[model samples]
Target: MGPPKPSITISQQAFDEMVKENIDDLGMDPTEALQDAIETLTLQGVDLSGIVTCKEDPVIQSLDRLKQLNSNWTDRIGKDGDEVMDLLDKLTELCSAEGSGNAAIGTRNGGIELVCSVCSKLRGGSDQGLVSGLKTLASLLHDVQSGDTFQRSGGPKMVMAILSDISQSSNILNGGFSVVAAAATGNEIVKESFMELKIDELMLQILRTHGEGSIHSLYDAIRILLTPDDNRVVASQVYGYARRFAKTGIAEVLVESLKEGLSSPSLVSATVTLKAVAVNDEICRSIAESGGVDAVLRCIDDSGEQGNQTVARVCCSLLSKLAGSDTNKSAIVQKGGMDRLIKLAARFSDDPSVLQEVMSIISILSLRSPDNAARAIEAGAGDLAIQAMQSFPGAHQMQRNACLMIRNLVARSPENRTLLLHNEIWGLMTTTNRIFTMFKQSTFFQELLI
Candidate 1:
């Protein structure tokens, strides 16, 4: 009804302290002090809308506010876009708070339909309002129950319409894709509904049109669509989706994004999305043939140079996944993949997680390939493995990964076995063996060492 208040948070202790100050410093009764505190904070422009209180349900109150705004939409349609945006922002904040149950409550109270209506009304009128509405819808859909409600309510169609109408605005597309991704997570029926809607085609069109704009959430949505759910009975659908993505040229577009000098977040998102789509050997080879291996290697090198361990670690993981194809393994080795990995290992030597990922790539590369094994040893793989084993003795996974890398390095090359043993690997192997033996339940460890 008036100017929207600025949304702010106060700690429970701070709020209590303020109430106590009113009681002690002003000699006010407890009820009077609490009321005075609320009035003072409200007059100072701090929005206490969703603040937890013993007397009222904040979730219901927030929903009522949204309903009020929606009921009065006609009167404020063109005159109060800012107020609409502010309400949507507050709703988004409430729904996003972890463990608040606000999303579940909102979902039960017809929140999806309310927000979708707002989105439709804001279409072609207020971009910011529409974006905020979409974001709030996404937050509400994070709950699985909310997702099912969204699916039955034809929310996906509304989202697709909004995305199509606003394909030119990166902000709107991001928010829209966020909703799509949230709706599709762990919900196979909703995923199928989206697939029937030809969500992939629409997504590819957006990627092609806005590829340079770097919509990170768009890549995330693509990954979620192609990923399988917990229901293993329908897990085979993921492979089909992977092939569809590759055939539709999604793989090539992702490879191109990897080659671009994207920021760290964008680079990680693109790499992760490509990794998700490469579900089979053929798609892995397809990515490699499209220069995916070279692009990933460059990213590893660049991220390592900048000391960005997260990007370097993710790039290495993607490269490892791509190297599941024998051809890509060879391509990676020839394009200096092993060299880049060794350098990455050296740069992030203190980080066992990155070291473990590098070791994993080496292990994959050397699996049954004596020449690649020989090349890895030459590129200092043995020394790297030994150093990792020594430095992080308590790092169980890294130790296991190092053992696997050692096993692969020597499995086919007798000379490598002798070389690694002579480099005092026997002691490190015994140490790792002892570490695993202490666990006493790791049959996989015995398999690796043997």
Candidate 2:
């Protein structure tokens, strides 16, 4: 024990091998014996790169090839053939291939690095090159495998970074928003990530700067963020997100876009997006402040004889929501919005869908506002409501809503009550009571009975 003996440990196999080598017979130190065993294993060509389990994944191998050949892939753009489509298909396949745990490999093995490099090149690249590169990135994002990876690895930031540089080129901007839209569609995580970047402002900027071509993607992106195609009720988080849109003047831009005509996709997009946020008091006020009532009324008028029923329905519903605010009700009535609505109700009296929305709006206008109630009566809304109830006798909700509106019309406006009574509205009271008694416990129905 002159010097304490050094200690070392080796795997059983290595220990046995050392023993078989007669290292103990030669009385070598334990550390020297372990060192000899390690040298033997290292010389045997064992790959110590920490990837011992997953065999040579072909997907990872192909991704590595693409990363190396990304420039070659870029050069294929503008060649005018199956080349671009082929490039897109290949990139899409690579991204999808990452799903079976290959994402981990791709993430670690330069796949995301390649995307960043492509984004960098596209920022300064020619328009054709930019379009192609952006499209490729969009398709990659559409694939579930690369979507999260793309978002987490600065993909969204890279996309946002290049947007300003490409703002002047419609093709380039459209392509950029395609990537943004794809990243946003059905992927809340990425959509929230984009929200953090104030992507809505960037979107409005696109509409402001690039004009018509950017409308589709901007609408699509906003739609995905706000409405979310699911059946779930719009949560407070979505409303909170929509407040940001209103702050960015989205409500104003949307109202102006309505000038695109009834059937215009942009027009429909604008209307629908506005409706989604109309519940916010500030947003509703913004709509009215932005001349939305007049613009919307004009759209309803423009829909004409063969008006888009869906457009009419959604616009009316939106106005109904906006009309909840007193100022909005005044704006609507002043803009002849109430007159147009009455006309629509009369014209589509047989269509329960349109009539339902009309009655709903009339009810809102009549509630808590004597002036608005008088305006509705002046617009022949009382007559229209009675007609809707009588004509759609079987339409339960229609009848209920109509009766409720009649109640609201007469609650504060004696003039309206006199107007309805003179028009034989009392003749429909029996019908109203019958319907109201059916749901007597409902506060609305109870109020209607009174």
The most accurate candidate by lDDT is 1
Global lDDT of each candidate: 0.81, 0.68
Candidate 1, poorest ten consecutive residues by summed lDDT: 439-448
**Superposed model 2: Cα runs more than 4 Å off:** 1-68, 71-84, 89-149, 166-168, 185-188, 212-214, 227-240, 259-265, 276-279, 386-407, 410-438
Error of 1 at 421 (Å): 2.1
Candidate 1's TM-score reads: 0.82
How well is each residue in 1-450 modelled by candidate 1, as lDDT tens digits? 764554675654576688899989999998898898888887877645334443355666766777787787784664467877887898899899997767766776678888888887887777788888999999988745677888888888888888775354899899899999999887777777887788878888888887634577887788888777735243547677777778888888888878884463477788888899898899999888888888888888888898998888888889889999998988999888788899999999999999999999999999999999999999999999888888888898888788778878888788887787689887666766655464447443344344
Q: What lDDT does candidate 2 reach at residue 176?
A: 71
Error of 2 at 329 (Å): 0.6
In terms of TM-score, the best-performing candidate is 1
Clashes of each: 0, 0
